[model samples]
Target: MNADAVPGLVAVLAVTVTTIAIGTWGLRFSRTTSDFFVASRTVNPRLNASAIGGEYLSAASFLGVAGLLLVGGAEMLWYPVGWTAGYLVLLVLVAAPLRRSGAYTLPDFAEARLGSTVVRSACSLLVVGVGWLYLLPQFQGAGLTLESAIGAPRWVGPLIVGVVVLVNVMSGGMRSITFVQAFQYWLKLTALLVPAMVLLVVWLDDGRPGSPSGSDGAWSVPVAGEGAIGLYTTYSLIIALFLGTMGLPHVVVRFYTNPDGRAARRTTLVVLGLLGLFYVWPPVFAALGRVYGRELVAEGHADVLVLELPRLMMSGLGGELLTGLVTAGAFAAFLSTASGLAIAVSGVITQDVTSRFVGERGPTASVAAAFRLAAVIAVSVPVLVALLSTNIGVARSVALAFAVAASTFCPLLMLGIWWRRLTDAGALAGLAAGGLGAGGAAVLNLVGVEGSGWGAALLAQPAAWSMPLAFATMVLVSLATPSRAPSHARRFLVRLHTPEVLEQAG
Candidate 1:
């Protein structure tokens, strides 16, 4: 009886065991801070690409995107497409240079490029904020999965994830996380792909080839807005997803693990392909969800659309077995993304906090210990937030996080890499403007100022306007206060733009 819950539990347990085992195995190679922070700068392009794909495909992509497509329709597909295409933007603009800078984290880039500890500390604060924002959904997704699959209480999933993640992140940092994420990538892809194939067969056998009734026509078409609010929300989302990837801390940190600029570029390209393949399935589930998952929608359970499909479509133990597989995949999404976020934020804290006391203390410092300590702090905030916050759709929460990242950090990274004249004063001012602008809007949204049309538009998509203001402030402020510019700006530019081999040989 109720084998649906049983098989689901088995699959979840199997995936969890595999993830922990891989992370433990990786600890053997992680000997020093360098290994923990950036994998000793030796991870090959192929495996690094897989790790990137795994970590990048967060709960938003796995569960949220599909749910959005089910609820909102074709406009939602752009989210995944934009997210993956962001790598191309990274490939052309910042991937190689960021990797070649030999910076383990974003703050390191700020300090090295601007030569200002003030700028570095500001960046550190932003990194921790964005990391925690990104992490809340991962923990929430975990809670949702356990509730649906195992009949567990609301808090159980997040608590389990928080403890497990703290253990993995503290054990080995980036070195260990790299292997864990790479393994989870294939597990996630397989988990989604297999159930999808079986579901497709079941749908065909049932002989309902046309569009689902409720989601047909208007709902299925691109830019087919239910109202003006939907239109503005869609366009704003497109902007946030397209521009936000460059600013994501965990995503940016992976570049530092590559051996050279060329490897970094290659890694981004492979990640694009892996992510592209994985994205194809979410829409499939979302579309079928429109048909088979109508009840979930009525019950306001859209995020669980992927989990509920098997039991709804197929009878007997086969459906339960398939639900188990999808359950495991969802867990992989949560674990891999959460682990990467913890590592990125913790690395920033460790580097920044210890730099205060030791001023680049020699190799003997307990930098690894600092990183482990920071990992605890990094994961703690989001867990608390997730527990306190009301449950929202996975995609919406993620988009809000993206809006925040796109507003604050995206401008900083773009200008830091390209605009040689940017000054420390300019950066700090821009960061303040963007953070306040976007953060204020997000807070309003949280408090439910979801007014219709333009009012809703303003709160929903603050980035398109806020990003420009931040960039303008940086340029104006930098021009107004050129005296604060770093003296070594030209030399830093050369090092950042040059190939890794050229820098080493020079």
Candidate 2:
């Protein structure tokens, strides 16, 4: 069977066009800034759950995880489990309080909680930086998936995604994005599931049961002499993913979009279920690919397992049709996740910078114009990086971003919301220490330093030490700078702790 991508590309574009139409239509409902930012805080838990799932399942989940599992054997399963369970940690620690804080962005919470414009500005910059870093893989993966499945040039996927994301974001903010993400979630799941079922049956019919004919070590086996290092990586990664959810600007922002704290918690639980279900399929792809996709490994095309499965398992027109379906699904993955990230980052730009233009220039188009400009800046850096770089692993890059999030903002948020002793100085010191620790390590990795064992331990799991350093720095600094603390510390604590139903706005 041969794969021809023309039909698949057409199908993907058609769906993308329909998605745009739906989002544009939703613009009528976005009447205020609050609506644009948090969907006016009215998104129901179920719909919000699907949207969260859609946004969370990026190219990493759709392509990288299965590819890693195919290449790394059993060790890669940790990525999905850790990712899904991160929400559980979010549920227990930050979800309700974050929602009740009435903050639109992370910076909003920082200013309201810590009473420091400097801190708010720092937080906002970090939000944009982290958001863009996360966005790169979505763009890169989109390009790779499209080229492999449809035979287009590398830039086509990212260009398509960038355009779609900009349109969705500019047409309607959170209100429209909420509906679009929910729809994309189901579209993505069906895209993968239907093709997977078909491919599995075809492989079974050919009697290629376990390891793709003659490839010996492709089963659920540990890497030779690397078990201990792998275990350390697994535990540390779990720690990062578990605690990191509270700090991710996009994820945290989503909770605030829910109507109430209870609804926020309920939304998280639903996300856990949806993410859990989505994760089950990736390993299946890896395992099945082991049985029928050894050729991909030999060809160094492991990432194309989901895309190439149809061609390998079937022949003739049936193969082409299945390839088209999988291509559409893969494109859906890129478009949905990229759109979500763009919206989050662009919102920060609009709120922080564009509002100033409105007050200064007296221009009627300031708000919308600023947001569009911000969207360009937010997506451009990541897209350029994606085009320039070639060595970073997909899962590793995403995890590093998670480590940065966990180490820096996690401490500030946990301490700010729950600890009354948290002061501006403390938060600042912690951010510096953790940002240096995690960010430095990530930079080293970016420069292509390969270290295993203790060296690997430092680079692979900096959060284990960096997170503690941030927490200790915050505490000790708070003690030393007690007088610099927010004057309304007690009042802020009361507000953050108050039930949404019982609270009165001050």
Candidate 3:
């Protein structure tokens, strides 16, 4: 590696070490198995909101959003807009009732609401699938960040991040996960915010240079692929991101840390503000990249634009310092979200998979041991997949994961929380439809499937149709199988709809 890259190397090392040190501090409070899974339900609103912002931003927000905008034009703004709006949808419809359900994971909610072990098991598998899907991009982005900043081999990035994440998770569980993520949120905001401000100043200093390649209108417009397919891709991406936020496994598990429904809603409200603030900067980077870093787009290395634009537009110590800062934020992006997904996936696996085989008596010992084992499995599989796969445009790959989540869990959560007529059989059928449709499309996408006309558009962006299909299948099956509704459905709905103080008054 070049000597000039030393600052980048230091920044990456410093972030990782600081993360571990903070996790060690949080580990002190994580004594029991319950503490490990949900931070013993003591996380406050601001802290939880910061943690959510940390985990929710992922590679897509850090690097992919800017890259997509630079390459695909203004149409790409939909990605960030839908992502933030999804929280509004969650806050209005799902947040409070979900917290009130008093479930540690989605499967816990499934079993509680429907009173069926069958639905719980299915939901468990879907949670693991979605977590792994989301995790792949983080690991891939880590490799990209490390390579871009300091010239480390791509594999080293994923390996180092995987190890660090495993240590954090196995050591402190949700307590450490929460602290690390909250810290990362601010780190990422500063990393992007400072550079964006400087870049804006630098752009003004340059007397507002013209587009590097000319035809600035193309890059500023809201169209990507034109015609019918283009329209489908844009709408499907919106559906996936807007509804998908409520369905992501890592995002949903955060609610379980809130002490009450009110706190859950408050956390979500704060999260929306934090996310809205952070998202405003990516487009700035994208627009600046159009002027200063156009070659990255031409070279098909757009993911590095955020890391490269600093050095491209400036010089000497100042540029190197900004590069290091973004590199640190990028690494934090991988570490925070990867760690959050680790806890989310492992929790489900421990509850449904590993815990089933844990032979020790009592809740504490068995749950802890099982969780440790599940954490290993949860982190390992995605690391392997990320290493074996080629770059699929980090943002695009994440969108596929969102498509699957939107199709499957969006329906289940919306219906399960709001519709008393929902049955386990209905949920099971809908999950199957959504999983098969979106999962099959995702698999095809990974294997390089495409063709002319509508097939390609539908396969490329399945959420628009798949989400509605899942909802319809769930509703129709639920209508036909009204007899299969949980016996306590009314009481459960009352509990969800009622405030905690009201339950006490009753």
Candidate 4:
């Protein structure tokens, strides 16, 4: 191995060992099925908030944002802005009611709300779809980070990350991951924050050079220079990120870990603060990349800006140490996000697929065994996909996942929580419409389709049209099929909106 790579190698190993050790420690509290699934619905607000931040800030946030900003300029800032604001939307609408639903997964909420096995099954499929879609980027980003840092072959990183995630998820599930994720959040924050501060000081000392002259003025503009297509794409991306947070299966599962609706709301609040604070630094990195690492953009390697920036700015020991710090953060990003997705996907698989074979009333050991088996399958499929697929930009790929979630589940959660008219037929129709619209777009993009027409722009960012299509389909179908509405929806809404104190008093 290159001596220059030693720090990165050491960082990778340290993160891996720390993750597994923490996961193993958490295994002690994961004896019950509920513990494996939702931490027995007892995670406090601050702890749950930190865990949410850890899992939510995936490789896309760690590496992609700065890279995209470096290449695409001001338009890409929308990514971080929309991502942070998404929680504000979630806080106002979904968090408390979702927790109050007493459901372990999104499908549980659907079935309870609409009272249809078909709707439940559809939801189960969507949950797995979104989870797999989201996992693809985390795995790909891991490979990218490893390749950039230590010259590992592209495939090695994904395999290693997949295996590490599988071990953690299979060993202890949600209860175990909660502690692991919370710790990773702080690690990730420090990894970026410290380097950014040091880099700023260095730049100040060196007399603050401007970005390369070859950079386009358009890079500073908020919209792409493609006129109508640019505006449409920007709005679509905004819609996806703004509404997508509540729809992410892993994110939704975190809310279920809160003890009650109030705790859930509090968790959302803390998460907003944590996420806002974390986001402030990526742009700093991106701005510095413009000054010191313009060649990375020219060479089509902007994704490594975070990993390469510190070493480029400072020499010798200090630079290598910062490089190692960011490398560790990037690995933690992959593991934490992948663990959450695995848990969400595995829970759905165990409940909807594997449990049928295991039998529903099986012993706790049988259920846990089935979940472990599901976790292995969940991690393996995505690892293979990451190996086979071309490397799309990590943030862009993750945004596609967000778009799919927004088109499908956003409408489901919004209407399910607030509207009494959402029938099983309506919910199913909305899911199908939204899934086909957004999923088709995602698939096309994944396979390397690209162009500059309106058609291309639509496929590139489907949330603007697809989300509205879903909401309209749901509302229209519900109006037409009022007779099919669930009888218990009224009571369920009361339960969702009522404070625990009010319920207890009555």
Cα TM-score per model = 0.94, 0.93, 0.97, 0.97
lDDT by residue for model 2 (1-506), tens: 22376767776787789779879988889777677788999999999999988888888888888888887776566678778888998898889988888888898899999999888888887788778768888888888887887677788777788888888888788888888889888887887788777777787778754753222453333332257665566667777787877787778878988999999999999999999888877777787888778788888888878888777778788887877877777777777777777878888888888666654433425666677777887777888888777737666778888888888889998899889989988888898898889888887887788875678777867887888899999999999998998899899888778886675453
Off by over 4 Å in 1: 212-231, 354-365, 500-506
Off by over 4 Å in 2: 1-3, 211-228, 358-365, 504-506
User: lDDT of candidate 3?
Assistant: 0.90
Instruction: Mark the 10 consecutive residues where model 3 has the least summed lDDT.
Output: 212-221
Model 1: lDDT equals 0.84
What lDDT tens digits, residue by residue, belong to model 3 across residues 1-506? 69768889999999999999999999898888778888988899999999999999999899999998888777778888889999999999998899999899999999999999999999999999989989998999999988889998899888999999999998889988899999999999999999999988898889766653323454423344667777777888889999998999999999989999999999999999999999989888988888888799889999899999999989998899999999999999999999999999999999878988889868777788898889999999999998999878789889999999999999999998888999999999999999999989988888787776888889989999999999999999999998999889999988888988887797
Please write out the lDDT profile of model 1 over residues 1-506, one tens digit for every residue.
Answer: 35557987887789878888888999898888789889999999999999998999989888988788787777667789778878888899999988878888999998988888998888889888888878988999999998899888779888888888988998888999999999999989998999999888888889875654334454334443667666666667767888889889999999999999999999999999999999989888988888788778788898998888888899888998888999999999999999999999988988877435443445624787677778888988889888888776677777777887888778888888888889999999998898888778877766666676677787877877777778898889999998988899888778778986775698
For model 1, state the Cα shift of residue 451 in Å: 2.4
How does each model score on lDDT? Answer: 0.84, 0.80, 0.90, 0.93
Clashing pairs in 2: none
Which should have the higher lDDT, number 1 or number 4?
4
Candidate 4 deviant stretches above 4 angstroms: 211-222, 359-362
lDDT (Cα, 0-100) at 57 in candidate 3 = 90
Alpha-carbon runs more than 4 Å astray in model 3: 211-223, 359-362
Q: Looking at model 4, how many pairs of residues clash?
A: 0
What global local distance difference test value does model 4 have? 0.93
Predicted structure with the largest lDDT when compared to the true one: 4
State residue 272's C-alpha deviation in candidate 4, in Å. 0.4
